[model samples]
Target: MVTILNEQAEVDVTPLPRGGDGLWLSHADMTRATGFELKSEGLCRGEICVPVPKGRHDFARDDAIDIAGFWRYLGHPVAHDASRSVWALGTGAGTRRQALASLEAPDFTLPDLDGRPHALSDYRGRKVFLVSWASW
Candidate 1:
């Protein structure tokens, strides 16, 4: 089984014919890992659709899709620790650029000292002072 780390979730899917850097998953596993369904139009998640390259054998074979290869084809970042069987996928550069173009910070929720949940949106419309420290 391989664990895929996406923006909002971590999904585990068994990889078929396990070898090489490519992460091949079945149709159901693909959807479970990436929320994308292989369609005649390409990979579609809701209204968003990404056209699969024509004659690209590296992307799909025998009902399995190489998600890592497909993500690379879309110019997205993919990081993997094969020993750990974990992969992390990042948003494409274009998506990051568009997000950066918007000055507003994305909303996120975190627990406070008392284990109370606090969301960034909760402090919206007011100046928020944030201090973060992490031991690397």
Candidate 2:
């Protein structure tokens, strides 16, 4: 399960559900999970070895492989099952690999709990560690 953002910007990648069964993802979730620095190369913000395809279309079909398209043609399903509505794609044609790229933390300004604008870039040149916890 990969969460993509901007389509032109790099993605942020992180593990799902504290070692749970399924991979859960969202645009904001990806950025916070991965770390800042979005690119098309599909590598972590600081590390190398991630792989993303170069072309936008399948070439054979001339259809674009935008996030949703990739999910469907690969045999995955996007559905609403009463409990949840999920959009999931397969790893690949036949490989068991999980993701094509790691998520990159995104940078943006949004209102905080107090309605003040929070700019992610404000932390530039500083090391920031963000941890996400949930009680369900």
Candidate 3:
């Protein structure tokens, strides 16, 4: 099983066959899981085809493309648990660096313990830790 994630979403895609050393899935599964589909031109979504650089794709013998290789080639970082069943993909380091450079937190609205809605900008002049935990 692999878990596809971005800053705002997480989706689990299972029953994907494994390649020699990594997960592999069809372009359909790729679209369902990652919202990116391989088109005649390149990896596409809707009317946007992300132009994949030359030699980025490494298709397995069975035509199951390597999931890790695909994301890595696009500059995202991929990590798997020791069991190798749970995979987490994050935005590229360059994007994170750019976020830091901006010195602005992405806007979000969430409820506090008392069910009070709060946003990061609420404390415009205060420092926020914004700690989060997950038990998965």
Candidate 4:
């Protein structure tokens, strides 16, 4: 059993594909993590249904549905651990598409060299060039 958490909730479930993050998740796990179910129409939560793309509705060797693949097909972001047990799926394609359409960076506060915080919104109309390099 693996525990997956999002911003608001967490659920324990068996992740498919043994050890690899193969885009698949057990139906129960997927439904609990996301409020949607893998329905005939698509991933549906309540009255709304986001149709899964044809051929992309592939399955894992164990026959679990590929929830991650569905999200990727819709252009949503997702992340999981090396164990393929935990996951953090981000906002769906609709939300991201709207953000992309607006072309606005979400407001963020970052710390400068002096430990002072700078908010992107503070320079609303001005252009800022950020050149960052790190020696890891």
Q: Count the backbone clashes (under 3 Å) in each candidate.
A: 0, 7, 0, 0
Q: Each candidate: what lDDT?
A: 0.85, 0.42, 0.70, 0.69
TM-score of 2: 0.26
Q: For model 1, what is the alpha-carbon lDDT of residue 129?
A: 85
Candidate 2: C-alpha lDDT: 0.42
TM per candidate: 0.76, 0.26, 0.61, 0.54
Best candidate per TM-score, number? 1
Error of 2 at 132 (Å): 2.7
Question: Model 3, residue 59: what's the lDDT?
Answer: 43
List the candidates ranked by lDDT, beginning with the highest: 1, 3, 4, 2
Best by lDDT: 1
Among residues 3 or more apart in sequence or in different chains, the pairs in candidate 2 whose N, CA or C atoms overlap within 3 Å are 10-39, 11-103, 11-104, 12-103, 12-104, 13-103, 35-105
Per-candidate alpha-carbon RMSD to the true structure: 2.8, 13.0, 5.3, 7.1
Which structure is stronger by TM-score: 1 or 3?
1
Candidate 2 residues 26-79, lDDT tens each? 334544533422356642346642344555433111121133433444444433
Off by over 4 Å in 1: 18-20, 113-118, 129-131
